[model samples]
Target: MRIIRLSVGLLMLAMVGTGCISKKKYDALSKDHETLRASSASANSNLQTCQQNLAAATTRVSSLEEQIAQGKAAITALQASLEKCLSGANQGNVNISKLVDEITASNKYIQHLVNTKNKSDSLNMVLTNNLTRSLSREELSGVDVQVLKGVVYVSLADNMLYKSGSYEISDKAGATLAKIAKIIMDYKDYDVLIEGNTDNVPISKPNIRNNWDLSTLRASSVVQALQNQYGVDPKRLTAGGRGEYNPVADNNTEDGKNKNRRTQIIITPKLDQFMELIGQAPKTDGTTPQQ
Candidate 1:
């Protein structure tokens, strides 16, 4: 009996020891699982960052490629221009270095001219917009404003400006003329040329001998009105005539004849300033080109 009791006690102690060992092993396994899960999360984060960096790099590369393509196209155009210039140069005993220098200077001068043209175009566009905006719909009914080759042209129908077959300004056209005068006064640097045009129809008025005389008188009337009544500078005003010679359309039809009989107010930048800009061409050797 005593031996049996001792055996039972040893059995119970062994079972308790086995249970403690199993609990310790379960705790260790749980810790290892958590460590593996944290490692996987860190790796995923690193992968996402790398992907973002790659995308940014791709965008930068695309921008650089486009810039390179534009540069190549510009180089090709410049090469073509240079080749054409060389072909036109004197071929016999040509000084290669001096010719290259001259070509460079010519290129610079061409660029200068292009810049000047762009500036003049901008000015003309501004002037046209300002005039169009300031004039009311009724005032602009028989008027056409346009910018052509860096010049502003305001074409007014003869019926709108003068009495039929006469050089006298009509009473109803006063308001429109006043608005135009204000615009002209605003652009103090620009000069105004009032040009009169006529159809091919012969005129036998008391004072008017022919179309030429009528056209010139019509232009003079507008010029005088602008200076005398509207307070426009006399020095900036010029009067001219184009009688049946510079027709805008065929004079055979009535509509065409009506279109041809019109007055044009040509606005241009001062010639002195423009001539000065042209005279100041750039030299290849960092000097100014001779006038």
Candidate 2:
């Protein structure tokens, strides 16, 4: 009976020890499960971060591609424009050279015209001075020598050239006409115009009809005297008349009437010479005119 009681006590102690071992194993299993749960949560967080990084990388790659495409398009356009410019370079250079040549030719022609005008003005001034110096002071009283628009005008008063109310030249006019004729002959290239002017006073005579007839007859008589008596070239002489017209002053006063009734000898370069000068202008291609 004592052997039997000792075996039973040993069996109870073994059962208590088995319960303690079971409790310790349960606590260790719980701790391992919590550790596994924490590891799973950390792995999930790392996966999400990687996904976000990949998305950003993809977006950046797409932007780079778009920028590269735009750069290529701009480069292509610039290359095309450069090629076009190179192809037309020769023609553009030629056009520019031609324009420059035309401008140069125009400037030269303008200078030529200015030079001709200066020479003409100088000649007119010299001619006027010579006439003024040749005439005596008393002769200069009734004669007015002037240079107007490159032409010489010698105005002679009616009392100095002709008798009162007559178209015939007076005997005193011979010396003055001779001096004028000598000047006209000296300028062989110049043409002479004898212009007669008359006052508004009406005249009645068997030979003279009106102021028109008187003025015309006076101009024609002067022209003939310069040709036949003074030996001036007839081809260079022209006759014209202004009846009660071309007045220098008011016709209401006697002095004005006297001034209105006068003869003018106009001397000018020949028309053919002027035409020749115009024809001698430079060509548009910058070539000089033929001599």
TM-score of each: 0.63, 0.81
Give per-candidate clash totals. Answer: 0, 0
User: Which candidate wins on TM-score?
Assistant: 2
Which lDDT tens digits does candidate 1 get at residues 226-256? Answer: 9999999999999999888889999999999
lDDT per prediction? 0.86, 0.86
Clashing pairs in 1: none
> Cα RMSD (Å) per model?
24.1, 9.9
Q: Could you give candidate 2's per-residue lDDT for residues 1-291 as a string of tens digits?
A: 345445545654575668754656555655755565567667778888999999998999999999999999999999999999987897899888988887777777778778877988888888888888888999999999988888999999989999888888999999999999988988898999999998899878789888888888899999999999989989999999888878898989999999999999999999998898789777777665554
